[model samples]
Target: MKEISDSTIVDVHARRIFDGCARPSLEVVVTTKSARVCAAPSYSDPRSSGKYEIRHFPNGGVQGSIDLINSIIRERLIGMKADSQEEIDGLFLDIDGTEGFENIGGNTAEATSMAVAKAAAASLGLPLYEYASLNREIGVPHQMPNIIGGGATMGDEGWKGRTPDIQDHIILAVGCQSTYEEMLCVSDVFHRTGILLQEADPNFTGGRDEEYCWLPGLDDVTCLDVLKQACDEVADARGVAFRLGLDVGAADLWDEEKGVYVYLKEGIVRTPDEHATYLASLIDHYNLFYIEDSFFEDHVELYVEQMQQYGNRVLVSGDDLLAGNLQRLEKMAGRCAINAAVIKLNMAGTVTRTRKFVEMCKKNGFSTIGSCRTYDSPDDTMADLIVAWGCNAYKCGSPAGGEHAAKYNRYIRIDKKLGEIPTFATFPGVKP
Candidate 1:
């Protein structure tokens, strides 16, 4: 790789673009000595977003983020070395001068940071993953594709304000021999699951949530049942094994004033203990391989209880709970009893911070799962990130759409170049 120097950078630019969800998002371009690379920021649903997160470009929208990047950020970063990711990211923090990126915007900083990384990788004639990490023996991550969607990602037009509170119903392709096989398994399950839902409800309307899961007028439990049936059928037919997972994004359903988890569709509310018990029952009943945000983000006690009860049987992962923050992860390291952490790049503001969180997870024996935002672009950056960091799993929505398939396609290319068979992780409920 080429050494980074002051002359490595030429210019920096930021602009507004529409993401896959047709929402305003920031795209940053970094011009280097040899290449120009562009990066688009990801978006998380506000309900499930971390309390500490910046206000999505200060409510200035894409234009505000673009203004900061093109002016102040550009002035500061114009002559810096693209390879100095930590220093470049530090400049973002220094300029923002706020803890949650309140000034410049987390999305803006992240887009610029990511674009710089890509530029540096290109200048060195290396892939982004390789430039980020020198290790070449990184394991190919298993796919955790969403099979059902609800909560914030669901549109109100379909179900007339009655949607499952749970955010995502995911499936882990546990028994696949390679990433290619895992992709096939997930694709089959995704389509078959949709077909099953359509058959079950002639009034399904074929409406899809953000992740493209069929938005049927079903309760949470019914959704799980449908997912289980579909996975079972697909596994049996394909001669492969699969396990279920859930990203409840429970913070979205928490009724702050009522102090309970409100299941509007079921017309029920559960206190913290009641909610934990319900989740435990679901995990046991379905033999769930993974469960994320089973409790609200700040509900540390409930997280600990679930981990104590089912940590040995499942990956009690934290997405909203940790929110890609090292401080939160450290605070909950041994206390919360979580077995896994979801690592999202934009949530941490920069690649340096994201990698730091990943290292923290490793040091504490927490398996890291690289995750994409709720509103992702066609960029497959997270795909390379997980492989480079050797995360245990990668979640980039369902296997159908081009936006989702881009990550899978990138992984296939990476796997081929590596000239080694991709290995799958050994988790609970998978046959040996």
Candidate 2:
């Protein structure tokens, strides 16, 4: 039997692979004395990458990231203890020397960091989640799947220059007895929404966006209406309750020079105050369970106001506003800006750092939702990460393709492995 104490990293390998978008991306393999493990980081479109996020690639493309990992990174890590995650991650920060990790790509460093963690866990004969959790108790995570997409993710495909202003419309199976039941509830709503869209629209292309979410080409409000109808039907059928959520992705709509949010597809623009009012209307009308990034990243005051007005009943969360950075989170938390946040592993660039971000959110009494990027890898580490950390929810987008399904399928496996169903996680003052 191998022990983590005796295991050391023997080799590090980095290579280029295609992400779900068929775009070049980074993958890393770590060989320890006891086990070999691999991992890849999620990728995002350069346009949508958070302002505080580390660069995904340098000038040399994916190969540039690969070279740095194979050369200097590998040299520094060759003989290090595989279990020393914090120390190893610290080395990555020191080597990069940039707050944004411009030297070694974030994707490269994140993948390498995850691979090492997995290798260490295997060396100790433990599952990655069990290893990372450090024996802390965790519960089954509720799934947050995007049922519809618009805005940047929708692009101009079949829309003829018209698409919803929001990026994602999602449904949460609020009260499920088990992870399997939650999966069934969400899946039913997702498929039912698609069928209803087809029947209601003559121009329905049966098209889906990059994340495999249906692109109905309807306006944001209409899309929400369709989603609510689908959720209502599913609830009636299964005797389940569902909650709605949105990734407004307002940063994409922010027109910096104009000092307003430009809804290009809708041909309307709104000042910061107007935008917030518009969002509030949606929340009230839909009784939204969650709303993410309702303002541009820099508009912290608006976030505070929104949270104050709706935080009790809704998850007024941040994604672009938080970007999974501790400093950003601190600033927001100091202002009591949000009630929930979206945590992505690559956003912080290491397993240790990502875990720290989640912990910090917990410390501030904020809900954490582990998320997947638009251009994600097929890697299922997020399943283990969210479970290990006990996040309130997991969002991987509709489970329409392999990349998305990988995480959901892994969650089911983990549930079966534990042989017990965890109670659903809920927002404050909300019951499942």
Candidate 3:
């Protein structure tokens, strides 16, 4: 067993069919066959509107920017040795130079690049993580069980037809138990909504072919009980430090009257502001790790107050605050507006931009977390980024979308490669 030679690159075409989206794809692995690789490998999910997303190409011919992914990628990838992390990264840089930021806005370059990595790993007979600088001591990542309600504001184009920027939050709770099992269950409210959850805009319902998810109605007391039970089970099985999270999604939510943010809206979930204290209390009670869109977007004062009070209890993350843009996050940070921010790929428009956003947030003492939209598939490219770029946490959704499953699989691969990581993964001196 020896280091893979940089002179050799492997090209292998692959196939993936998940959540009803099936197509033939290509993956290129660049590494030497002689590398004493521990494992040569490896590695999901979604979009917001019609403008984003790379469709599966079963016939091998797809339209849009995806067609820009040339078979030339195979040419540049072949004969590369996976001797070190720097070497592989350098390879990517060189390929990308000719390719040049081709994989932005759900571009096809993403699909092609992902496939190439997989092929390169297999060519070397080394696990993808091993050759790709994977750490083999990190145990699989753990996510807390908190329901997320996805509410979208409907109506209007500009300010004229623009209905309120609010959404109906239907809680979709994630479950992880002592048996190392993580399941996502919805409340009775979503159950009642039935097909309505799937019918977001009705006129513009994306992922029309995928299964719809929503929260069924339930009393706050019942929802609380369910949440507590799930929390208890997850904490006991995994470590309490594993983490819990929530996303209210404030872009569709707003508040000009209450002077509060969008999280206080009624008929969504948790009974508006009535449960703010209760929710905060629970967060404190359970040592919750992260909270997103808690008080709506742009409610700087509300967030300031939450941070002042709960700063020592949990991490209050921001999504709409920065809308996945670093410049916005920096502005918000300068104003002392948030503790954490979400990294949405489309929001940044490209992987390059997204990386900059993550870097900027980290510079400002913020944790960068990866996330997914409701509409998704078996594409784990983002999941791959989460590991490669080292996100604090990832919200790919309740294992429903094969996208979730795909990401979960990638995480498992990471854990297998890296081993178990130190339990010292907390906010640390941040007082969160």
Candidate 4:
């Protein structure tokens, strides 16, 4: 067995920083006897988030979270072992003493927990991912980059009196052997998709949403068609295969009061079953490799039905449905018909719990995808997390933007260090 270091933490510090959207967020640094590490929590768009999640930070903004971390959390954690991740995070739970981290703040707990892990990895002179897991077969996750945008991320400004209910239209480079190749394939598709959009609409302006998803004046189905045509063109030109994915974020369209999904742009309403059938048809029509949150978080039965019907053909995934919570994940484990779960570390409030959730998913034969927030800081921690724990897929928006590029750059660095091209996951068995 390899000997691990037992470095004791000497200090903990907290500060306020701005995320991608200039929203207030908390950042923390943990110092061990030999090294130090820092981290910050990312935020999701309000419309795309789960209904049951705790307050992102305390109501007082970043200052409140920093105050709690400095005054209450620091002293308790300073003398603990940095290498003991579970113990450090357990102390966070005890200090907060509230479900969903309503007291000390989820963002604070997440920043502190991740900082300690990074400090421990630094102390051991190992990469963050290597320190986090014993598995050496950590392959590169398939990259899903958003090519089109709609719903909450776009708001009402760019829709031109029409609202597309779907959240994101993404692309998958399924047949690429390495991260570099996958990136090239997606980049080509992104540019080609843009050219096609510009040609189709004479008044089209080059505008994008927060995640760099193209803001085109087209309905959901029309956007999918455009993306598919772009993918076909890119594949033929580059000699690589690609597929389409959707982050439907169905909760954004669900009407809790009326018990129907209101597609304001299409001018139609759908019950759970009608919505499921419509989504299934879309999957078949576009040959979608991944579909996320086809139903709202509370609609477990509907999710199960979709999973049963299409899990074999597509990655029936949950983002809003799971929201990185252990109890919710456990509820969907065997009972719900999901084949994959999106793991966003901060949403779970700690790296320890996030790993536990990934383990739970693996045990239940579900693939795990490490995902980033739409409103994120310029931190590459998620890049390390995905590689370190060996997730099956990764989603961090387009290759543009500093926040998104940070993740892609980290993966490129990792690939360079390995000196060997890493294998990528193939969904739907990569049709001929």
Superposed on all Cα atoms, the candidates' RMSDs to the truth, in angstroms, are 2.1, 1.9, 8.5, 2.2
Candidate 1: tens digits of C-alpha lDDT, residues 96-128: 888688777778888888898889888888898
Ranked candidates, highest TM-score first = 2, 1, 4, 3
Q: Quote model 1's TM-score.
A: 0.95
Query: What is candidate 2's lDDT per residue for 1-432, written digit by digit as tens?
Result: 233555699999998888998888888999998889989888878767666777776668788888999999999999998899988998998999987778877777788899988988888888988888877786778898999988778754355247677889988887677888889899999999999888766689788888899987577888888999999999999999998989998888888999999876677899999999999999999998888989889898999899889878888888888877899999998998898889987788888899999999989888889899989989998889899998889988785888988999888888878777665555544442
- Top candidate (TM-score): 2
What does candidate 3's lDDT look like per residue over 266-366, in tens digits?
33333345435655775666555566776645557767777777766566778767666555677778877677777765455444556667768767777
lDDT for model 4, please. Answer: 0.81
Q: Which 10-residue window in model 2 sums to the lowest lDDT?
A: 423-432
Error of 1 at 328 (Å): 0.6
TM-scores, in order shown?
A: 0.95, 0.96, 0.59, 0.94
The C-alpha lDDT values of all candidates are: 0.80, 0.85, 0.45, 0.81
TM-score of 2: 0.96
* Model 1 RMSD, rounded to 1 decimal: 2.1
When summed lDDT is taken over every stretch of 10 residues in candidate 3, the lowest stretch is 36-45
TM-score of 4: 0.94
Better of 2 and 3 by lDDT: 2
Worst 10 residues of 4 by lDDT: 423-432
For candidate 1, the clash count comes to: 0
CA shift of 118, model 4, Å: 0.7
Preferred candidate (lDDT higher): 1 or 2:
2
